[model samples]
Target: MLIKGFLDALQPEPILSVSQWADQNRLLDSKSSAMPGKYRTSITPFLKEIMDHLGEYSPVEEVIVMKGAQLGVTEAGINWIGYTIDVSPCPMLFVEPTKEVVELVSKTRIQPMLESSPSLAHKVKPPKSRDSGNTLTKKEFPGGILRLAGANSAAGLRNMPVKRLMLDEVDAYPVDLDTEGNPIDLAKKRTSTFAKRKIFILSTPVTKGLSVIEPLFESTDQRYFFLPCPHCGALQHLKWENLKYQYNKSSKVAKEVYYQCEHCQEGIQESEKTKMLESGVWIPTKPENQNKKRVGYHINSLYSPLGWKSWEDLAIEYEEAIGDVPKMKTFYNTSLGLTYEESGDKPQWEALYDRREDYPRGKIPTDEIAFLTAGVDIQKDRIELEIVGWCEGKVSYSIDYRVLMGFVAGDGSAQVWQKLDAVLNETWIRPDGTQMSIRMMCVDSGNWSSEVYAFCGRYPPSRVVPIKGRDNQITIISAPKAVNVTRKNKSVDGVKVWHVGVSLLKSELYGWLRVNPGDPGYCHFPMYDEAYFKGLTSEELITTKNKNGHTVQRWVKKFTRNEPLDIRNYARAAAHMVGMDSFSPKHWELMRNKRTGAVKNKVKKKSDFWN
Candidate 1:
């Protein structure tokens, strides 16, 4: 009794107002206790960390958080919602990916917190009537109501007028719904009226291209907390490369370390990281005007009070389990607050850039140019057409790209003929009155053979041809042959015309296409697929004998596996067919000399013949 009285006396009498004492008692009672039937339970540290941030209201309009799995981020969000309801009441919407998640979160995380937290439970009253399908309005505190909706339903999100929007697991939200708009965009409309609205988009990283969370992260005002280096007191980003083992020679694995100071070159250990935490800083260095007033937090299980010790133990266990690689990159990035590149895949960008210069634009030769051919790969809805103008000693320029839509009619037979006729009318125009048309246009008749045949009937005997190949062995239906045409009676413009086979046109194109490295004009063809250049593998060009004992030299793709679109092969085949030369003599000689055991042979074939 004496000690209690002394402690009370020391507490500055006037400072202990009824409200201040009540607030302290409320906070003390809220701490978790082992006693049964204790209404006030202590909030978890993870939740407390988030609550602390919310406790300080700033001008920041949004918070963008990137988190690892199971760090109570959802629970933290729930607490924030409840806190807002108690203190600053506004119409808020909680959005989840599906109806199931919405129901689960409301029942499990939100309801329990409001019921248990004495301060919050006292402020917000119960719902008027519990059974409303479209609206579940609970008058918890006084000023406003909290609305819950699933992003999965467009009508549910679209109708709400929300001041604060919490989009949960945005990465999981469906990008495109046939009848409804994108869920994220639909949710954003709910808060369009409120200028001082708060928006929180939180999600774990998913595969690169499609995830909706990417846009929020790219925003200017989104602040990422940067930790300073304890060793040198420099502000630096935590990266995976900075962390290394204590002994480089003895240890094969890298230890958990922070980036060294750029000036001092000293490593920042995890134990000393507490000094570096800057609570409110934007990431990626955004411009002042474009900033959205945001803060980001990366949460990991290591920060959880429940699993704190377990995290340390698991780190040791994981070191033994797989040498060094974590189950997912999120494990390292989230726990250590560092960034890492996605592992295990080779990027296709490099291969495309390597051969970028090889394909260039050039003038169409007047005298030596023999024929033009088009290779059409037709699909059900779309068609990929590559048109090659063939000359004897030049690289073929892809002059036209046509992407056509609409369904084909009559089992695609009539449609193919119509498309072929349209293509001929649009592309095959002669300067003179003579019918200057492609010698032959090859259609991938693999899927629609009958359609190809029907289309071919519209042209002269050898003008339209079908390509035949199974398992990458492509061959023209008719070999290269010439058809003579002469005017019966000679007139001023009357002249003889010759129709050539598809193979003859291909042969002409092959010689004409040449790789000129120095000329930018010939190097700037943008239509070529970048993936084709990247996937090219070094292979042995072999001469093999056919069944008839004829030696045929074939340049085979040498990769261990085959890619869906072998651009190099297609380009080479297109070049071969159109008589486009691979490169000039000087360039070819340099390449030949650079390669080991490369032989230069001058034996001219039909494909190599000029005019």
Candidate 2:
């Protein structure tokens, strides 16, 4: 009768709501966070209603939160897990983008939640306890177990049935897992055995229609957190555009950021957000929201903590990102909680060709030139070269493109090599008769590796760099490494080859091609042959399943002859080598004055538009 005696001793406490329990017990520790304190629902009142849905009374089978970074989505999720452990223990699954995230969350979030809360600490045994079922990926309680896994692992998704499942950063999750149809569907199957199952999915959206969270949110009763203006007393949703301030062009900053009341036309300071959120309520556009078992909530960084991402902070970030394509994409996804829309396809070859400016092939106005870079594409029969002029805001002007006709006769002794040398040394005369030579040239080492190494070896590394196209996610260029197995496959001093991220540059270039002229990051097209535009627009980005059944994106050619695109990609890489990112305003003025040899009339700033 040991069990009976233990049951008698264990007194059943009064039932309390999840939020009520958290306010009375949950603690945030210094080990896991800087703001360590007891839990309070008032800090993020908008989430209390969402987290309480995990209780037995709520019928929501699914909850989707399309949120930005540092918005407490992860913390709210941990609260639900703790509530489950203390009140209604059941099998749960916590999934992240990868195995590393799973391990990280276990150590950072779950551990702190259990150790900091007395009720949860007493219910769940620690790792050292003899009967405590605690591990990095799995935790077993008296009646239930919590399992952790990455979306990439198929076996983990199918292993055990669960009553509660959470998928963090759902947009980053691989579209598929091995042969499993969909990771979401696979994870959903695990909860099928339990009649009362709860699943929570959250992420910052990726792209329109392709984002993992968008469709899920659209299908549910789409809900948004609406707050009443402190002055106007009128309820309205917080949006990025609602916040406004003066942008100082010279300083590259928004002077001040304050929300304008749409109804009263009064300014709302961020300091007042605390009170406004205290009176906030979530409104659902779909009336049948209560009827549906699934619900969705969307919130942006606008609702983040006061000191965390203030109105001015977000404003400055937007001002900086508006001029950069990749940064703008990130802003859309993270700051606004919106999906980035990729232009339908690479700019049509005809469109770019037809929009060619009056500028001659190689006579780009020196005033418009900030720096110059050249790309070389080596082929068995010939080599291709392209010179691109980069100005402020990354607006690149096509200077000239030429094809050298010859073959590699005997190890860098070909006429093609001589032509390439002449091209590299040739200076393009500007409108003012000032000459500008290529500052950096990238020669393709992927093909004709031995010959390319020999030709580039003849020149100093500062003048010519041997490069091969590679696919990377972070940046356009990777650190220089030993050339791919060469004639001897031996390392040479000062002989380093760069890996150009073809995929990264191609994506950025495509974005530039789509932006209208006069816009930041717009790429200028000079008078070029139809064939040149054809090759430039030859490839398009496509999403398809990889060998692991996971969805991936890459550029694929529609037809043949993509050398024009290749040269452009290489030129972009060369642009980085010549300080494309670090150039100061003084450098641009110096570059502009090189042609006329005129004393600086104006101290040009980085924000100045290209001439």
Candidate 3:
């Protein structure tokens, strides 16, 4: 044993890169990784250089990454933490957005990481009841300690001095922690004591102006991964615009999904992605800042490896997210790794009136009409409803609007509801002689709550949706909630009401109303009178201070008759509930075929009757 120990001591210690160290020692836990076993950097070759730059030997002090989801960036961070523990031990701090997220990552990610690799497990001991060194938020090794923190906690940011700092999902962090100022600024102060400190900031960006990572990313030498096209050998980075797809007519999947080379316009299949990635290289866009001791990297989900998020799935997701603002925002931040820009200005109603189409008010215009939805607005003396035809890409046509004048509340409300039932049940004729029925109808419960609920409850929940509008809701439409109503001194059960985000819907509608006729999400209107246009443009969005003294946007009526705007948002809510938000091109094609086939069969039946 002494002879062996002497021989081992005589051998020189080996220097290892972070990627090499992770490949040799790290094991991906099944609990966290899709493929659980020995970790291999070759699977995602784009991450190798990023991981190596984070190694102890590299001179780079700070690394900023603005990345999309499912790209193994977070796993690279875990590898860095594991490498520090197993190889170059130092005081390290990892910060998530909140305490709850820190707890979740510690339990699901950090703990499993330690247990998966023997080298990491040996250095960072498991927590026990009596062990203070190894706990949920902290881990101690031979030469250093690892601490987990939350950006929301001021105490966590000020707890200790750390040489290695990692801020994950920094965009989700609050602007100020307990009014102590920026959490990132506070966390950076902890590393001032160490000259060779390393800082890594990573996030999927949020809004353009409100993003925390975009400005930080702009400060460093920005690096992007470029791959050579297999067909034409042209080197270029993958872009959302370059990805093309054609949906299958019979199936709900893409018939063809390919990347068009930016240089040669050659088609590249997904199977060639592996070789392209293996040969990919990162080039700094700001080469002048290469020696600044800081580096930044940006990549989107298009670079995700094969079997992880395919190009087809991204195309379909983008297609479905085209018209909905919230869904588009999520796709941009999570799939494109970019911030979403919001347009809050209202569109002028005069433009809409002048560009109105000449289609008939009560008939479907063309095969473009995939379905129909109606929105009902209840007033004291009458009920106003608008029927809207929805097409692919959420292009909508204002088909018809009717007012039933009567007592819509208290005594004679039953007759008004009966009139509404007839309008809802009417079949509208398409230009091709195909018949279309109202798929769904949303009745506003804001004016006469009990009466609206009673009218809506008469039909199936799918046919008639009762909705109450709420300001500043996070989502456009929420799931329906069952409420009890009292009738004749007895409580009735099972009336579902959905809460609608009027503010968000109005924002989306006004944006679409501004689009030209040929563009996606453009609104087409029939020949309505001047008063109709006035009511449609009745409310204008105004910025004002709320009770908390914070700036907020509110819709205030410029005209007394705002039923057109109210009923339009209700129609949008009906469309949203009936899957308009997620319908792809194939879905529209199927509906079109169904209507055409039905019309042909009806003609054949009439011909056979004459024969």
List RMSD in Å for every model shown. Answer: 21.5, 8.2, 9.3
Local accuracy of candidate 1 as per-residue lDDT tens digits, 1-611: 99999999888534222122223333222222232242221323323333444432445667666665555466556655765665557788888877777877666556655556676666654434353222232333466767777776776677758888888887667554435667777777888898777777787654333335554566434343454556655565444345444423224344453445565788655555434442222245454525435655554433334323233343543343231122233344445433332231232444435544343333232322334556665566655565555432343344444556644434443454456556655433323222234444555555644444344433443444445433211121224323222222311111112122222222222222233533221322343454333333322234455443323333354454222222222333444444333344455344323322212222122221111
User: lDDT values of the candidates?
Assistant: 0.46, 0.80, 0.83
CA error at residue 86 for candidate 1, angstroms: 0.6
The alpha-carbon lDDT assigned to residue 106 of candidate 1 equals: 67
Instruction: Provide the clashing-pair count of each candidate structure.
Output: 42, 0, 0
lDDT of 2: 0.80
| Local accuracy of candidate 2 as per-residue lDDT tens digits, 99-173 | 888999999989888998988887778878785779888888868989999998898899978999999988877
Which runs in model 3 stand beyond 4 Å of their true positions? 1-12, 132-135, 231-234, 249-252, 353-507, 515-580, 583-611
Against the hidden reference, what TM-scores do the models get?
A: 0.44, 0.74, 0.67
**lDDT score for residue 144 of model 3:** 96
Write the number of the candidate with greater TM-score, choosing between 1 and 2. 2
| Pairs that collide, model 2 | none
Ranking by lDDT: 3, 2, 1
Judge candidate 3 against the unseen true structure and give its global Cα lDDT, from 0 to 1.
Answer: 0.83
Best TM-score among the predictions, by candidate number: 2
TM-score of 1: 0.44
